[model samples]
Target: MDISLKNGYEELGVAWRRGCEFLGTDYAIMGGAMSWVSERHLVAAISNAGGFGVIACGAMTSDLLDAEITATRELTQKPFGVNLITMHPELDQLVNICLSHKVGHVVLAGGVPSKETIRRIKEGGAKAICFAPILALAKKLVRTGADALVIEGMEAGGHVGPVSTSVLAQEILPYITEVPVFVAGGIGRGEAISTYLRMGASGCQVGTRFVCAFESIAHPDFKKSFIRANARDAVTTVQVDPQFPVIPVRALNNEGGKKFIETQHNVIARYRAGEMDLATAQLEIEHFWAGALRRAVIDGDVEFGSVMAGQSVGMVKSEQSTADIIQELVAQAASAFSDHEVIRSNP
Candidate 1:
C-alpha cells in the first residue's frame, strides 16, 4: 500500500490514486451518472471538486448531448465521462459524440451494453463502465471489455437492482479478473464510503450525495426533501408489473408512489386495448417521473413529483458546494479508517 504520512497530515491525494485528473482532482473517486437530474453544471462541479462526474443522457437529444460535452469542456479542462442508455434510439449517436470528445470514460447504463458498443468505446481509448446487478452480469461485462463496473444495490434511487450492495459487492469483487469494482446505491456519507472500501471496492461512485449539492439542477424542493429525509423515509414501491418487465427502484413512499401503482393498472388497461405498446408504457413510466421530478426538484412540489431517493437520504442535511461535500466525505472516510485501525490495534 502507498500510504504516505508527509507533513504530519493526511491528504486525499496521498491516500488515493493520484495519477489521472478529473475536474481538478486526482482519480480517487467518481460521481455516478444520474438521469434527468445530472446536468452540465453539476457534473462540472463534481469534476471541479476532484472527482470524475458523468453527464446523464436520458433527456437530451443527440445534438444537445454534443453541446453539453462542449460546454463541460469549457467549464473545466479536467477529465470527465458521459453516460449513455444502451436502449435509447439515439444511443449510437450519443456514443459517437463521447468518442469524438475523447471523454476519459463512458458509463453505459439502462440495459446490458452490447459487446460491439464496449469494443468501440475501448477502441476510442476511453474506459468503458457499466452497471451489473448480479455476479453473472458482472462476469459477462468484464469478458465484454468493461473497464469498470458499478454494483447498485436495492437501496439506490431510480431503477436499483434487487440485491443489497453488501451482498452484491462481496459476491462480485473477488471473482472479477480485470475490471475494478465500484459500490453505488445508498452511499451518502463519509462513513458509508469507508465501510464499502474496506469491503474490497477500489472506490465509491456516489449519486444521491451529488443530488443535494447546491450546484445540482434538481429543483429546490427536491433538495429540501433530501435534507429532511432519513433512512426510514426511503422506500421501494411494490412491483408495478407493466406486462413487459419492471426494475424495482427505491424512492420516498409518497403519494407519487401510490399513483404509480394506479397508473400501472391504467397501463395494463391501455395495453389490452392496443392503445400503448410495452416500450411506450415503459417510457411513460419514466415520463411520469420527469414532470414530478422537475416539479419536485425545480418547482418545489416535493409531494407530487416522484422524488427518487436512496436509503441514505436520511444522512444528508443541507445543500453545500460539490467541493465542500467531497472534501467532507473524504475526511469522514479517513476518520473511519483511523478509528477502525485504533480498535484493531488495541488489546
Candidate 2:
C-alpha cells in the first residue's frame, strides 16, 4: 500500500480501534445478524474477512443453534457473536448452549432483556450486546451490565423502531459513553461508517449490504430482488389497527407485505366482532409471516415471501466476495482521511 494510503487506513483505524478491541476483530464493522440469511457460511466469511459476524438465532431450537455455532467455528477461528431473541421460550437453554461453546459475545435482541439475563451472560464469560432504539433504553441497558449497545433505526431490515439512524445517533451517541455503541440501519458504504465513527460511535453494523455477498446462502432470486431494488422500494409493514399493534418490519414491498396488511385487517375485525380474543388476534397477525423469510431466502419465493432488506439494499448492486466487500468499505473510509490530508497540505 502507498504511504498515503497507509496513513489514511491508520487514521480510520484510530477512530474505531476501541470497537475493534471490544470485538477482537481487525475492523470494527459488524455483520448484522439477519434471520435465515446470516447462517454459518456468511457468518464465517464475514469473520474471516476481519469484520465481526453474528449468528441470528431466530426461531432456532437449542440443538440447531448448538450445531450452527460448532459449524461456524470450523470455518473460521476469528470471533463472532450470536443474536438471541429476548422472547425465546428456551432463552436460558440457548444461553447455556452458547456458553458451553465458549462463545465470546451474545446479543439479546427483539425486546429489552432482564438484568438477570445480562448478568447470566456476563457471569457465563460472554459480553452482552443489546439493541437500544432510544436513549433511555441505552442508559438502562448499560446500567444493567450491557457490555455494548447497538442503536438500530427504523431503516433497518426486519423489525425496527420509529427513529431513523441519523436521528438516533444524534440523540444517543452524545449521551452514552459508558460502553461501545454501534450504529446500524441504512448504513451502506464506508463513508457513512466513517461519519458515524467521527460522531463518537464505536462502530457500525451493516445487514442489507451483506445480503448479496458471494458467500451468502440467500437464494439467487432473493439476491436479485436486492440488486434491482431502490431505497424507496424497501418499506415498513403497516399496522391497520393500533389496538392490534404490529411491530413494524422493514422489507421490500411485495405480495407478502400486502398480505400482512390484509391479515391485520381481518384479524382485527374478528376481534371487534368478539369472534376471537385480543391475544388470539395478535398471534394470528404475528404468525402470518412466521415462515415467510425462510421461504424467500431459501426457497426463492421472492414474489410472495418476505424479502427483508434495509434501505441500503439499493447500494448493493452485485454479488462480491466477503473479503472484497470489507476491503471496499475500508478503502472508502481511508480515502476520506486521505482527502483531508491532501486539502490540509494544499491549504
Candidate 3:
C-alpha cells in the first residue's frame, strides 16, 4: 500500500468506521447491487477486495437466486449480501433461499418492506437492510427490525427517489442513531464518502462506479457509454401524461429514452380515446422497458436500450478490477482526512 493510503486509513480510524463491524468487511464501502450487472463474479470480487458486495436478485426465480448465492459462495468466503425487491411474487421463498445459503445480509429494495419480510430475514439470522427515502421511513425501517438503512437520493441510477443525495443525508443522518445509516446516490469518489461519514453516515452504497468494473458483466458497449458520458448526459425519463404516475428512472439519454416518451404519448392517446383505462395505460407505459436494461447490459445496445447510470458515470474513465476500484475509493476517502490536516503531526 502507498504511504498516503496508509495515512488515509489511519486518519479515518479504520476500526471506528460505522458499517465495517456490522458488515464484517474491512471497509464500510458497499458495491451497490445493479440488476443484470451484479452477479456472482462481480459480487465475489467486491467481497474479496474487502468491500461488501450485494447480488441483485431482480425478478429472478427462487432457484435462480439460490444458484447465484451458491456461485458467489464458491468464489469467496467473505460475507456478501443479496438484494431482493420487496414486490417479488416469491418474496418469502427468496428469503428462505438466503437463509439456506447462510447469507450474511439481505436488502429489501423497490418499496416499503413488510414486517413479515423483515422478520423472515432476521429470523433466518441474516441482517435486514432496507431503503429509507425519507426520515419517517428511516425511523420506521429501524423500528421494523431492519439491521441498518440505506438512504439513497434521486441522483442514483435506475429507479430513484425525488430527493437529492445531499439533502437526504442531511435530513436522515442527523436523527437516525439507533442503526447504521449508509448514504447512496451520486457518490462517485472517496471525498464524497468521507463527507457523508463525517455527517454521521455509517458508510456508503455505491453503484455507478462499479457498473464499469472489469469484473462487471455489463456489455462492452454499455461500458463505453459510461466512459463517454458526462454528468449532463444522464437524464431521467418523464411521464407524458399527468394522469399516469411517472417512475423517475435515471439513465443515459439515448434513442430508447426518447422512444419511451413517444410510447407514453401513445398510451395517453389510448386512454383519451376510451380504448384503455388509466390503470391499463399505466401498465403499458411501465412495460415499455421490460427487458431494456438487459438489452443494454447484456447485448451492448447502448443506443436503444436503457443505459442506466448515475451522474457519476462521468467520472468513470476506464474499466478496472473491483479490488482496484475499492482501493482507489478508500485512498481517496482517506486522503480527505489528511488534506483537512486531521492527521496528528509528529512532534
TM-score of each: 0.87, 0.96, 0.96
Ranking by lDDT: 2, 3, 1
Tens-digit lDDT string for candidate 1 (114-165)? 9999999989888898989888999888888898888888878877777888
Residue 96 displacement (Å), model 1: 0.9
TM-score of 1: 0.87
Candidates ranked, most accurate by TM-score first: 2, 3, 1
Error of 1 at 260 (Å): 1.9
Model 3 C-alpha lDDT per residue in residues 213-253, reported as the tens digit of each score: 88998989999999999998999998776788888999999
Backbone clash total for model 3 is 0
Best-matching candidate per TM-score: 2
The 10 consecutive residues of candidate 3 with the worst lDDT sum are 338-347
lDDT of 2 at 276: 96
Please write out the lDDT profile of model 2 over residues 1-347, one tens digit for every residue: 77777888988989999999999999999999999989999999999999999999999999999999999999999999999999999999999999999999999999999999999999999999999988998999999999999999898999988989999999999999999999999999999998899899999999999999999999999999999999999999898888878788899999888878888888888899999998999899888998899999999999889999999999999999999999999899888877776778899
Error of 2 at 260 (Å): 2.0
Per-prediction backbone clash count? 6, 0, 0
Which has the better lDDT: candidate 1, or candidate 2? 2
Clashing pairs in 2: none
lDDT scores in order = 0.77, 0.94, 0.91
